[model samples]
Structures are given as C-alpha cells and as structure tokens.
Target: MSQLRVLRVVERAHGILSSRDADAPDVAQVNEAHRSLRPEEVSKAVSACDRRDFLSMSACSLATALLAACNSRGPDEAEKVLRFAERQNEVVERWLLRHTAMNHARGRIAGSAFPMYFISKTLPVWDTATRGPWMLDVSGLVDRPMRFTLEDLVRLPARRQRVDHFCVEGWNAVAEWWGVRVSELARVVGVRAEAKYVDFRSFDSNFHESWDLESATHPQTIVAYAKDGKFLPPPYGAPARLHSPIKLGYKNTKYLTNVVFMAKRNGGYWSDQGYEWYGGT
Candidate 1:
C-alpha cells in the first residue's frame, strides 16, 4: 500500500543476471540499491532487461499506481500521481507542446478530481480556497535558499518542450508542460562547490527522489503549474513539481513538499525496497 517498491541490481554484463542482493553490487557497480524502485533499472539496463519482461513487471507496478488513485482512503493520492506524470510530461514537451498538441491540462477536467482505478493517472490538482506563498526553497549545498511565488514564477521567462516520458515501470507517454526554467532556478539557488546531488520530496507522507545536479538543470527540467492553459490539477502537483529529462517515474513526484540539495546522494523511498535510487532510466 505504500506505493513504494525496491529493486536490486544484482549483476550486469556477459549474460543473464538475477541475484537480489543490492548491497553486494555484482553488476557494474549498481546505483541506489533498494526495493522502492522496483521495475526500474539503469537506462542501458532497461533496454537489456527485455521489453516482454518489463511490460509484465510494469503491469504490476502500473496496478499499484492505479490502485493508489482509485481507492477512496487514498484521497487525492490519485491526483498526486497523475499530476506528477503530467508535470513530468509537461517538462518533456515544454519546448514542443503547442496548441496542436491535444489533451493538455486545463482542457479536460477543470477543477475536477481524477477517476479512481486509473492506470497511473496524469491528472492535475488544486485548492482554490487556500493559497500558499509558492516557494521553491533550493537549499542544502546551494548558495541561497530562494523562494518564489506562483506569479513570481510565471512572470519569469518560461520554457516549452516535447519529449518521451519513459517510466521506470516500462511504458512511455508524450505531453507538453509549461513553467519556469529549472536552469534559471539553479542559477538563482546557486549550487555550492560541494553540491553534487539533489533530493525532492512530496506531500504524500515522505515520498522522495534523489538525482545528480547534472540532471537538475536540464533544459527540459522545470517546476510546472499550467498544463494546456489552466492551473495544474492537484494530483499533478498543482502548486509545483520538479521535472527533468533524467530519472524515471519514481523520480518525478507529485505534491512536492521539498527540494533539498546535498553533497552526497541520499537513498529514495523505493530505493530501500531494491530499486535503484539513482533512477537514471
């Protein structure tokens, strides 16, 4: 029920590999070792894992993503998942998404909730009644712990793009997202000399993702709000979400709670389960 899974990269190279002990890296020095990142692997490893195998495993992972959305107890959990996906997709297509690209947010469900049982919902989320300062605190190994409002963000320059979103679970989708450039955010935060890794957190309990700074400033990366031409849905991390050309589904989180910069990389939620925390794919 945690929506958290772990995957361990046992061995790599030569032939078929299948050992589950992540702690003991046998394969080309595995990335973040844990189960929280189930159905995930290095980019090249993903291709090597075989499409048939990934699809079958992804069926289960997708089910998990769906169940989390449909269940009533989960509340806006579905929206959160969808929002994360949409935002990530947005970042992917920020440059390519145009009026021609249909199904962009702000068109379908205006201030609505995502359906339950949706296989990995990519819905947006919001709360008109309550408004927050909307600050992207870039702390940790950065120069300043900067903060920005929604207007403050939108007012700044924007980036648009279109790209493929490869989920760790073995599936892909394309979408257009719009928001402030992450490259600018990095420039504002000013990464310090020691900064090497970046950690992202969500409002869903303590779900989080960790990635290298190299991916943080990716042009395709941005903190989005408007999808299509409307406010971002709640499940889509209405207030804000981090998007990057790097990392997998687990790395793109919804209902973003915090974005922390650290010198060394910290393990992610799914990483503890056996999944690769680095989530390069």
Candidate 2:
C-alpha cells in the first residue's frame, strides 16, 4: 500500500460533503451521512477535519449547538469534535488550509541538541552485508544516469556539516551529517537543462518528496550516510538519506533509494496534506 493511503480516506469524506446541498444541509441529512460511514472512516474524518467545517453548514443552529456541547467537553473530546466538523465540510477544510502557518527553512548551524524522531514504524534498516547490494538509482532528465552503491558514494568528494533540522510538527534539532553533496551528484549525472525539480524516493512505504532544482543542487543538500561521525542508525535512516539544510525535515526524505530529476512539480507527502510546498529557508 502507498504511504499516502490515508489521503484516500480524507478524499472520500470530502466526496460526501460535496454531494450534500451546499446552500444548506439539514442536521438530519448530515446525521444520516455521518451514520452511514464505517467506524474507521468516521475516525479518519474526525481526525483529519477541523471545526470550521461544521459551522459553515446551512444548519447553523445545530452546528452552533454542537460547538456549545464541544466546549463543555475535555480538550481531547473538543478536538475530536472540531476535527470531525472539518472533515464533514469541504469549505471548512479549505478555510483551515488558508489559515495554516508555515515557516521557511532556516539553514542554521547546529545547536547542541540532536534528538531523533521517526515518522513510520515500518522504517527500513540494513547492516553492512545487507546494504552491500543497495544502490541509489539516479535517473530522469540526466545525460549520464547511474546507480551508485554506498562504497561508490563514499569514494566521491564528501562533506560534513552541522545543520539545524526543522519539522513540520513544530520541533527542531541540530546534528552533524557527512555525505556527498547533491550538486556533485547532479554534475556526475549530467543533469539536463530542462530539469527543474528533483524527486526523492524512500525505501519505507513509498514515502517521497520533491524539491526545486536549485534547492536540490544547493551546497547544503547531500545524500548523507553518517550522523554525528558514525554510521547512521536505523531509527535515523540507515545506509543513506537525503539531507538538506534548506528544507523542512520531511522534505529531507530518509532511507532514500532514488533521485529523479524532472520538469514537473510533484507534491510531497506532507505537502499534499496541506503543508507548504516550497518549505524553503
């Protein structure tokens, strides 16, 4: 399954909202729609939506009552009500998207902290023997496409730097990384003139991200194999990962397996989920 399968559930919820009478959907109609959803689907709708959606419905009286009821609940219960509302109304979701706050990547020097955070439980891990057969496939919009092994990459001119990492989840960490600069990879691959973006693919759950060609080839962008002067651990993305000081942590995809230069803009995992697409410093 795709790493983004949850997006489908969100999309389905939107479909239900769209099929309703936009001018005003009655509370009974809305209730029927909610009740028709599967238990897991209802959870997805609630978890994925925000409060504004419910308020925008034509049945304002019912929605206002729901809001009042929500206020009397605990924080967790209130949040669930708001999320359910957001998922139930498409207009509300769009409004929330417009109001979201996003920060540009800072590219700052590392501070002392280096806490690690992993997103998915199904992270790909490899030992020296297991990684021996692993190779990074570099293709698309390049003259000299190549597959590079870990040893092959280590032989290239390598760089090390301490960079501040910012997550979309509102956390930051600083760590030292060692890897071959992405610009060198571009040069070695003979990137074509029309290539305007670089798409990175991960080994875990088909997680992927794309960056503008300029950022992709930036000096601070590298395919890192080591962290804090040691081989990267599995929790930190072993074998190799894409690292960039000028992008959000999500944009710096981990367990990187491929790099493809292309002309079109491809939305990333979180970016598709309403995060900033540029995500630049």
Candidate 3:
C-alpha cells in the first residue's frame, strides 16, 4: 500500500482499538489493511511488535488480536504493532518535511499572551549569582567547540521571523521571534560533515531533544532571545531558547544551556516517554 494509505489504515485500527469495541467490521477492516501490505512490510511490522513490550495490558491484548487475525503472530509477539506503525509514520513525515521558509506575515501574529511551558515546578530562572553567568555551550562533532555568553549571542547576526507555534496538546499560537539563526552558529563553529543530528538541551529539569540536521539548519530555526519585540521574560524562557516553526513546542527546548551535534539520534525527554520523536508540525 502507499504510505499515506497505510497510515490511514493504522489510524483506523488505533481508533477501533481505543474505542474498546472491536466489532466484526473492525476486525475485517484490520485484516483487509494487513492484506494490502507488501510481504516485506508485513514482516517488518511483525518484527517491530516482537521487539518491544506494549504500553498497557488492554492495548496489548487488543493489538495482539488485531495482528493475529492477519499475520497469525502469537499474542506476545504482536504487542508492539502500534510502535511499528509509528515508525512508519515517522519515516513518511521525514520524507515529506521541507526546509522552505514558512510565511511570517505580520497579520498572523497572535495576541501578546503566548503560552509558557516548562517542566520545573517553579519557573526556571538563570541564577547568574549562583551558576556564574549563564553560557550556551556548543560542542560535539565540530571543528571548534565554543561557549557563548548571552551577550555573545546577541552580538551575532540576528534574524526575526513570525511563525506559528504548535503544541502537542492541540493548541497553537503565532509569535515573532528574534535571535541568531542556528545555521549561522553552525557555520561559525564549522560543524563536521559526519554530524547528522543536533541535540538541544535545557536547564529546565534537564529537558532535551534531538533533531535531524536538515531540520536543525532550516533557514527559520533560531536560538531565540526575544519574543514579540521584547527580550524574553523568565516565563517564556528568558535569556535563550530554541524556536522553529517546523517543530512542535516540546522539540524546541527552552531555558537553553547546550547544543550538541551527534552522528546518531538520542531521543528526547517527551519522546522517551512515548511521544513522537520527530515531533514535526
């Protein structure tokens, strides 16, 4: 089946399972969906199921039955079928992602109140007195590992773009961001060709995320210092934070501390907890 069609089937199957009422039609739908998949795709789907435990007992039983009706895998080996579907979704999302700059029209900007999100119990402020002045460290797979004071970042060439911010929880806002483009920083530091991923780390409970190099260096991706024409307040990740229209809110780590380039992907905090790792908008 085509990628899009395959994804639709997976989504249908999930909805059926979640409803907790997999009736006769739902079972037939799942069987028909699997019948459309190529032999290699079927094998891979079954293999992925065999590799990981399911997130819940009920989900496991439901998915196991769904797969058993088609592939005849044992219940235990069918638990991660959903995970396989997720990986396929990621592959399709990555293939479809583009680096073209998003339209940032001034009229699209939202009201002044952009939602603030951080995992720390209290707002995370950079205690310069205790931690010494906050510095952003850029290292790993680069010709010159460097540290930048907030002032140093301000001194770099700046870019301003108004873009929509999407949250995984189903809300979105539009805001203007001003900061040095991460691509500029990569150019200055001389990122090694082998570095295919970028890891963004934050001081807010050590929350972090990794991104493919293509998305990291997109023209609009920035390490933002200002929002809506004002220097960021503590609630909005003062000092500096990663921002991009291409990624979801959680992928843009706030209260920034470190940026590392790596050859392989290291999953993020939310991603490690079962959120989609790619997190594309």
Q: Which candidate comes out best when scored by lDDT?
A: 3
Report the error of model 2 at residue 52, Å.
30
Worst 10 residues of 2 by lDDT: 94-103
> Higher-TM-score candidate among 1 and 3?
3
Candidate 1: worst 10 consecutive residues by lDDT?
Answer: 110-119
lDDT of 3 by residue, 1-281 (tens): 56556665665655744465455345677878867777665444445542234346668898787776665544555559867988999899889877774646444667566788899999999998899999999999999999999899999999998888888888788998999999999998999999999999999997999999988998889999999999999989988999998898889999999999999999999999888898987
- Candidate 3 yields a Cα-based lDDT of 0.85
Candidate lDDT scores, in order, read 0.60, 0.74, 0.85
TM-score for each predicted model, relative to the true structure? 0.53, 0.59, 0.71
* Candidate 3 ranges beyond 4 A from true positions: 1-79, 101-108
lDDT, candidate 1, equals 0.60
Local accuracy of candidate 1 as per-residue lDDT tens digits, 1-281: 13221112333332224444354434444443433234544343435566668889999999987876676556564656755775575455444533233222223232233221111344433344574555556677777886677777888888765445556778655555677766687788787878877888765556777776666666666777666566666655667776654556667766665678888878777775656555653
Better of 1 and 2 by lDDT: 2
Candidate 3 worst ten-residue window by lDDT: 46-55
Clashing pairs in 3: none
On the 0 to 100 scale, the lDDT of residue 55 in model 1 is 86
